[model samples]
Target: MTPVPTAPLVRWYRTSLAGHPDGLNFRRLWVGDTFSQFGTQVGLIVLPLLAVSVLGADEFEMGLLATFETLAFLVIGLPAGAWVDRMRKREVLVVADLVRGLALLTLPAAWLLETLTFPLVLVVAAVVGVATVFFDVAYQSYLPSLVPSERISEGNAKLQVSQSVAQIAGPGLGGVLVRALGAPLVVLLDALSYFASVLFLLRIRHREGPIRRSGRRLHSEIGEGLAFVFREPLLRRIVATTALGNLAGSVTNSMLVLYAIRDLGIGETGLGLALSVGAVGGLAGALLAEPLLKRVGEGRTIALALLPALPMYVLVPLAEGHPGQAAVTMIATSMAITGVGVVVYNVAQVSFRQRLCPRPLLGRMNASVRFVVWGTMPVGAFLGGVIGSRFGVLTALWVGVAGQALAVLPVLLSPLVRMRDLPRGLDQHA
Candidate 1:
């Protein structure tokens, strides 16, 4: 793919308040993402309810469902980055939203027709997963185009706030809707949210010039992305830490709903409430991200954010020994701390990468990082299923917690711990 112009990425501005040129465009992206993420949170709650409560899916099936939702990242992650780089990113974002919206409609249709099955659910999950691959790569790549390089951290923080708010409310809303409308009908809300996202995206005025075509082989383009990520020492350590965290998180997530419902005896409402309460920490984290970066510097923020939260994951399995309401409280508390750590860490690391990569390589670079970090999820989900099926859900949770504790080691041991601030741009690193 021919590289997009880099001027906008380096463009400086005196202000980025709401009425400013950059601010308006960033708001469009932010609003659309907020809707999309809200729907995703709803689906996160409702989909498992559909499979577990409605279809009576076993632990392995639940794991399979989780696996399929993330499988596209491992399968097409590299190539999708190459493709996104070759296209207009706004168009890619719109098309991905359309695909996910349309695909989600099938779940409701099948349920209404009395043909809903685990396989059908898996298929829809996979389709959504595929669209998500393009959207995520393009979304990260596109952000620098809309904001000043100096304020990229602020931009990321704003977006994280949107997601955190959505996470806090989406689950509780979904649970209430599930009780009133049934799980199948509740999925329609997610589909409609995607359509709403499309509308928000359409109103954005910022436009990329026509992409220049290139004769590069697909594999070569993919390889370049991989090499860039793995070659940079900072990028390499970030990727290792993030990949390990994701792997461990996915393992715990794979069985969390089932365990909450079965062993902990929390109903859908209780489970949703627990998750909703937990997400309050994400909101707190998002609000704190920029301030933390300013106060502590990016490197320390990244290295230390997870230290408190990850160790708290052990509280999840220990919840198994508590009574129902007590267990829910424990789970919520654990998740809340985890949320704070994750948001702060992501804001620092993501802003670092965005500022560090050259404009032309942004898509590939983000994709490569995602390919490693997110690619581990499917494997972790499957392993969680196998372990949950054989030993118990509590045992799987313990294993996941152990992995999470170990995930922070790479970044802590690196030179990042010694730095007060990170390099501002690729030129600084070069």
Candidate 2:
């Protein structure tokens, strides 16, 4: 297949921002992304709160909610790539926003009708997950087309920083709203955020050409992409390690809030504040990633970032304070350190992926990797629920945090750790 024309990426900005002409278009995309992230973070806090508070969902139910949110990555991850490569990505993003918005809207509607149920939350979570699988695939693919290759790291950093900012603000605000209006109504904010994203997407003046599909075999294309990922040594290691990391992280994340409430005795407002404190680390990591990568190399940066996460993670189960000293000190420290590690690892790995892949294969390459890497989330979520149900939530968290440190093995054992820099040319994959 020939390289698709991505000139439309430039048309969106067609101007400058903060006195930087080169980044103007990116700023426009950034604006929409920032708003969208705020909404997502708000929903992130509110959704589970609704499940716990309104529906009285147990650990298994809460875990199931998390499962559905990521199940689509495993189910249609490959096919979505094939579809994305054949359609206008901008349109996919818009539709995804609308779908997520509509899906979230149902919760408030259900609440008004007094028909909201845990099962309904599960279904909507699945729907939103499906949309996200496509949106994220397209969003990653679309970025390479928008910026000069040299600036990819900058673009990613800006986007991540904005997301971190959202993390900082969204949860606190959502918690306040959840406390003020109740969890069900708090979802309305998320729904509106999606609509806001849709409007921003629609306002872009850029245009994309329709793909020709006369002789394309979808499976063949999907296989081609998958082959590229699994066959390449470096890509394989990254994919493997990421999958394990996510699986382990999900195990803890699946039960984090519940653990906070039960074990730590953290209230809604306090829970949000705890999460916000963590985002301070995320924000710091985003700001530091590019500079760190430049100094230490992607491999070293990843190693340094990830090595601390597990040790920090283990401290979470030990948090003793309810709302004051122990809660603020122990739980907050764990989350903040983990957040830093995650962001740094993400920025380095993502930048490496964008720099390494060929432009023509961007969408499928991203999807294939996403499939293998992200596919573990639901499994992990389910396991977390089972472990929490059978043994205990604290036990599940311990097992999860322990496994997180081991996720570094694949990359550490591979050639990635030996390098001072990522290979800019595909021929240097060795």
Candidate 3:
């Protein structure tokens, strides 16, 4: 891995914010992040619902929409990291937010004007997808710069709480807004969320110098990030586990709503409730993560979180009932478990990555990681669609769930299993 150039940061262990120990800068970042993410969650639901309800998209079209939504991770994931490293993280984040907001705003306008087309929806999805590639990479990279090194764990844990809260709240809020104002109006909420995020980001007073240009060729820089990840044993392990697991997850996700509504006899309301119930587990995981990590250590925490979800995944495929009320309970339980496992693992590993990698390479490293890990999602969604259509949705569920279950094996056998704490280097900010 390439070494990061260490920058000095303030120690924030003694501060109090509403009785919390984190600093004001982190609070600003978190608030902005939460607002944007809440909007994102709203957008995520409203867009697809609109696709089906307003655009009259079929299963195939929904699959394509899912693919386009994440395909940017594979397409621009690497280079975006490189560009992010050459630019101010805040600027990159702000521009990405603006782009996403503007792209989404077009949807409501087109719908109001009665000029919305299915292809136009796909274009909007794709554009947002591309901008997200940059936003996400910069977002992850920005954290270590905003807080003390020792506090990165707390920062990550806190951020996960916001995300988990969003997961729990965003969908329900979105549903209500959709019901009150309709789908297009619900999209306006997301567009406005981006603006809200921008407002918070603009309020952040942290400054950055001109991007340190390595003057290396873009492809070479991209390759360097990839090589760094592939070369390091821990990162390599993380990527493999996440990539395969997410691939399977994408399959389950792609088919979940369709199967619930079409095959399992569950209605949209039941499906929505099941998903909402499932998000509670994420909130729990985020809240419990610190204590869990304190007791179990990082490696085992990562491993244990995902391990339980393996067996829990079976309930989804075996779900049965008229309206699948019982099945819905079973499925929601499974999602709850999956959410806990995923959130804990995510929070722990993000802190680990921030600690392990040099600051200068954080953007590229995260981007590279996302490239390999998240890139598989689009493929998995496409595969899920193919498998569900060909073999039946239940069969597709098994394949996806089974893949997710098996992905944990790589970590159990690797160096990650034995580590008590993540290794930190001199390049880290302290």
Question: Per-residue lDDT of 194-288 in model 3, one digit per residue for the tens?
Answer: 88998888887877766787867999988878887888788788888999998998887777767765677665556666777888999999988
Runs of candidate 2 with Cα error greater than 4 angstroms are 1-18, 209-214, 320-325, 425-430
lDDT values for all models: 0.89, 0.82, 0.82
TM-score of candidate 3 against the unseen true structure = 0.92
What lDDT is reached at residue 204 by model 3?
78
Going through the candidates in order, what is the number of backbone clashes in each? 0, 1, 1
Best by lDDT: 1
Model 2 over residues 184-236: C-alpha lDDT tens digits? 87898898988888877776555654563637688998988899788777778
Window of ten residues with lowest summed lDDT in model 1:
10-19
Instruction: State the displacement of the C-alpha of residue 344, model 3, in Å, after optimal TM-score superposition.
Output: 0.9
Report clash pairs, candidate 3: 4-358
Worst window of 10 by summed lDDT in candidate 2? 10-19
Q: Mind giving the per-residue lDDT tens digits that candidate 1 earns over 371-421? A: 999999999999999999999888899889999988999998988888869
Each model's Cα RMSD: 6.8, 6.9, 6.7
Best by TM-score: 1
Instruction: Report how far residue 151 has shifted in candidate 1, in Å.
Output: 1.3
